[model samples]
Target: MHGPLKGLFAWRFVVRAEDDVRHPDGRASTSLRQGVRHQDPEPIVANFILDTASPHTKVCPETLIALRYNGDMRPGQSATVIVQGVRTPCVVGRPGEANSIGAPFIVDGSLTFYFDHRLDAPVLYVDDENADLRCRAYR
Candidate 1:
């Protein structure tokens, strides 16, 4: 069987050293935010800082609360995540004391940081638009 493929692109911004500070206990930390959306009748969307080091995606408590109003979401539940037109299955978890994304969806995406004397920016590409791919941005 064959299906339509989709792709999405986004720009990345760097958090300044002053903005990226260490916790009092001595933990390296940085501020990185990205746009995330879910494919639903009333889509759940928010801007979340990307954490490549994190094995599981984390969502903000408030965001989750809002999502609950729209869809049935439990503390330990699974939801479909749409990022840059890519779909990925992710577990739902509250950020608790930490600021996090509402939908902790994970997908196979690429992030490239360009470093040049004149220009410095990072770009994120989610999902490949190859003809052979089976994933679709929309149902």
Candidate 2:
């Protein structure tokens, strides 16, 4: 039951990073880097996917900043996240890249918002563990 979400209010999810990575193709990976070239976590501003059936949410480097999570509301300034008490650095780029701002996706199962028109909506990442937070703006 998915269609154009026009004129409908947008929603957000603020969740903690899980140890699982659900790829766009419905494949689950253990690490986000997928063992390509593991690096430390860094500050980022990226968009995430809002899946109602999904048990988790994800973010890239760009959406993390644009959404103003982890104290990165200003431009030219880096953002960061703390995992296990260790602070790591991160940045946002494009999808499938090491540092993407947002990852495009189609979420079905439990998303509950109204749209007057169809939209490829952007879901910002919040500095939370659970992807259940909400935002008030549309970017």
Candidate 3:
């Protein structure tokens, strides 16, 4: 008795920092957290973990520090995040060292993750394309 296995496991997302972005014009963007925001220090690729329960996108504090992210966010702040070559101005902060790509980013980017569907791998799909594994723009 053999059949296709089925289960919903946490899917991981890997993305690279396209560049350091800051609040444009310093006009107090309501889209961002209600506080002072700053520009990114540097840009570098980072890995992420998908979590639907999370309300905002979270990056490792170490990476934020390395990138010179100087924003005021107890939860997070709006920043430009590049995923699978897709860019979106979303909230990101140094919640920890591990990148936590939460529902906010996924919903904003319209991404999908598949599992237990007779698939050959564990990965998130952007616009229904497996471009995550072969994105050159990020490189």
Candidate 4:
């Protein structure tokens, strides 16, 4: 399939530390506010952290339950994920409580991290094909 670069594929979100929150009473909250999103028709739309070190992409059990996805567990299952208009075939698996997109999605795709020297914030870039190689190499 074609890559995200050919389509509109990009997501942006805010990040805050656990200790960096203000309560209604103007008190500092110690709990972390994890990034999350929900959309209709699709059933579930939770925020996921991209982990380049991880070997496989995984979704939280809660997300699967929320989606009401009743597929066979044997050998896992494949799902078509439409990101920025690009339909991608992804292998779904159960991992921890948090949803994470790992190297499995990146090895064949292109990734770029934008960082500013003055800020700790970063922006992630994804493309269907490896920009460096111009195409995905399979062994």
Candidate 5:
């Protein structure tokens, strides 16, 4: 197993756009598409997953807590999020829900470098300004 990420991991990246999130329970019942979801019925912000192969960001519980999106959680909840100019779908879940990384908001989806294979693991970047989320591979 890889070592745990304690400190010295945070970056700045804006939420380019919100995408269509899908889950096994079907599409999440939300109306957030493009920009941050301010009045989400259950408002949420989280660290998303990123890989050299993927182009979208994923959400984490801490991010959710940071964004304040606390409500029913379902697996396979996909969202069509955008980063830079790439539009990709983002999946959602709870702590143990499907695709659950067990780490709340490790990458806020906007920042890439989650699976760089060069570092140990992904790190969560919590920006003080507006609690913006982001991710970056360890150097």
Candidate 6:
């Protein structure tokens, strides 16, 4: 239920910053709150452009510039973006860590887009066990 997207169109879509984290007291956190380190409502939802040529997924340069990123995108250095969405510690990254102007992934570089031209609807397979978001691109 997550791949083999077949079509003849440029790839692009909106990828959401998952609200998968919970606070110590079991609260959901998102960027739509205040007092969080990177409190802002604009980044929770952003755009993803398919670019198989680049080596790894990266934030849009301008977005990073706007966030004034200073090595915050480094490995093992996550921030507490929205410390409290509804009432917990969640949300991560700056304003541009999710956008991909070029590239697809860094640590998990297993995504590849192929057009078989024989299927319908775009699909995304998040291989959680293997931590892979590998998928075929479509709309």
Cα displacement (angstroms), candidate 5, residue 47, comes to: 5.4
Q: What is the lDDT, from 0 to 100, of the residue 87 in candidate 2?
A: 28
Residue range with the least summed lDDT across 10 consecutive positions in model 1: 9-18
* Each candidate: RMSD: 16.6, 13.8, 8.6, 17.3, 10.8, 11.2
Q: In model 4, what is the error at residue 15, expressed in angstroms?
A: 19
- For all candidates in order, the CA lDDT equals 0.38, 0.33, 0.52, 0.43, 0.37, 0.35
Q: Name the lDDT value of residue 55 in candidate 5.
A: 39
Instruction: Pick the TM-score winner.
Output: 3
- Best-to-worst order by lDDT is 3, 4, 1, 5, 6, 2
Q: What is the lDDT of residue 20 in candidate 4?
A: 31
Per-residue lDDT for 57-119 in model 1, tens only? 544445545433323246556544443444444455665523232223333442233334454
Ranking by TM-score: 3, 4, 1, 6, 5, 2
Whole-structure CA lDDT of model 6: 0.35
Worst 10 residues of 3 by lDDT: 1-10
Q: In terms of TM-score, how similar is model 6 to the real structure?
A: 0.33
Q: For model 5, what is the C-alpha lDDT against the true structure?
A: 0.37
Q: Which candidate, 1 or 3, has the higher TM-score?
A: 3
Better candidate number, 3 or 6, judged by lDDT: 3
TM-score of each: 0.42, 0.22, 0.50, 0.44, 0.32, 0.33
Q: lDDT tens digits, residues 37-139, model 5? A: 5543333333332233433335433334343333333544543433323333456545532122212233343333343456655544333443342222210
Which one wins by lDDT: 3 or 4? 3
lDDT of 3 by residue, 1-139 (tens): 1132233234434444434343567553322222323432234666565667978666655555544444543446555556555554446555654566778667655577665446655666576455454444434
